[model samples]
Target: MTNPERDPESGKLTERYSDEDFLEAVAELEPASTREIAEAVGCSRRNADVRLRKLEEAGEIRKKKVGNSLTWFSVE
Candidate 1:
């Protein structure tokens, strides 16, 4: 997945993150919600959710329902 960032001064597009970035964010903030992960990754919650689901499918992460929200954790 390509996460592009726009330069504030030059208005140029730049790559901001990668799959590893998302993995690191989840590892750092284990048992975190999508919102939290997104905030940490400087992306939108929806974007985080999409990547998170992919990670979960790959068995790199796991998710559990905590009350009304789903919390994600790195798979050790």
Candidate 2:
């Protein structure tokens, strides 16, 4: 899969991404907390949480409750 490209002007991503992109982002940040995943994927924490839940349910990743927060890890 092609990596998302960054905007030439602002240097931020300007394209829409698929769930696969989010999965790749999560894998890049394996053992990442929700916030870290969101930051890495350029998504809001709430949006990241929703996507993470789906990924977890699909067995693409794992979410472990650590203290008061959840940490995500790549299944691979």
Candidate-wise lDDT, in order: 0.86, 0.81
Q: Counting only residues 3 or more apart in sequence or on different chains, how many pairs clash (N, Cα, C under 3 Å) in candidate 1?
A: 0
Tens-digit lDDT track for model 1 on 1-76? Answer: 3568899999999756687888888888887998999998888988889988998999989999998877999886
Q: Estimate the overall C-alpha local distance difference test score of candidate 2.
A: 0.81
In candidate 2, which residue pairs clash? none
**lDDT at residue 11 of model 2 (Cα atoms):** 96
Itemize residue pairs with steric clashes in candidate 1: none
Q: For residue 75, give model 2's deviation from the true position in Å.
A: 1.0
Model 2 Cα lDDT, one tens digit per residue, 1-76 = 3356899899998545567867887788877899998887777899889988988999988988999999888886
Which candidate comes out best when scored by lDDT?
1
Candidate 2 minimal-lDDT segment of 10 residues: 13-22
RMSD of each: 5.2, 6.4
Model 2 TM-score on a 0 to 1 scale: 0.73
Worst 10-residue lDDT window, candidate 1: 14-23
